[model samples]
Target: MLTEKQIATETHKQKSKFVTVIHPEKLIATKTTEENNDNTFLISWLFLIGSLMFLLDGFIELSEGLSIHVLLHITASGVFTIASALFIPKK
Candidate 1:
């Protein structure tokens, strides 16, 4: 048995009790970017070392006769380089 005015007043009271808000998604994006950068840095280091080892082994094999040790080093370095290139993210 509420009047029109009473219903309106109750609606206004309920609306006043609730507030709307906005949130930014940039914070999450920034954290993700930072994590990617860290991973890229680590992978870059690994790639550089691996590339150097591969080159050194190639040079040794060229200057001297091919040995089992030199062959093993070359194979291992090649595998590391390929792995890093495939898995590393560019950020």
Candidate 2:
């Protein structure tokens, strides 16, 4: 029976037989369309979440009364929401 180490070594050798090591330049030359779509999706979701937070902050300010603390929270949330909307990519 083969030892554990010997079996592992044989498995590694077999795996390497089908492995291709492409150069960095070759990899950079490839275009990935899926990556762009995924990025767009992520940005849209971020923007949506930020908008929701902004709306929630407004509601809190209206419902709970505009104290200094509530004003600060609303201001901070608004800034973040605008920043997200501006930075995130659109589909």
Candidate 3:
């Protein structure tokens, strides 16, 4: 009868057999607390700003006439803008 702790250890050992990890600590080291909120907030806003700029550039190019290129530019910018929103800090 294995204890819960022993079971978890055994499971981890078995999983490690099929996969090799280098610098496993770094995988989990990035998470902490609210201290990272500021960085996330700034980076998310910057990313959104860049996306907006790209969208603006697409608009400027719009004067050239609507075509596949303009549509693609607007689409890519929209995707990145949505992704950047995921990084916004939660309250």
| Per-model TM against the reference | 0.43, 0.48, 0.59
Error of 3 at 61 (Å): 0.8
Q: Cα RMSD (Å) per model?
A: 10.4, 8.7, 8.2
- What TM value does model 2 have? 0.48
- The model with the greater TM-score, 2 or 3, is 3
Write one digit per residue (lDDT tens) for candidate 1, span 1-91.
Answer: 9999999999999988976665578555566767778977897878877786786777678578777877777787777777766766655
User: Which candidate number would show the highest TM-score if scored against the true structure?
Assistant: 3
Off by over 4 Å in 2: 1-37
lDDT by residue (1-56, candidate 3, tens digit) is 99999999999998887756679789778776676887788888999898889988
Per residue, candidate 2 scores C-alpha lDDT tens digits across 14-88 of 888875778999988876988877887797777869777776967667686767777777777777777777776
TM-score for predicted model 3 compared with the true structure: 0.59
> How big is the positional error of residue 84 in model 1, measured in Å on the Cα after superposition?
2.0
The Cα local distance difference test for each model comes to 0.75, 0.78, 0.85
- Candidate 2 Cα deviation (angstroms), residue 33: 6.7
What is candidate 2's CA lDDT for residue 5? Answer: 100
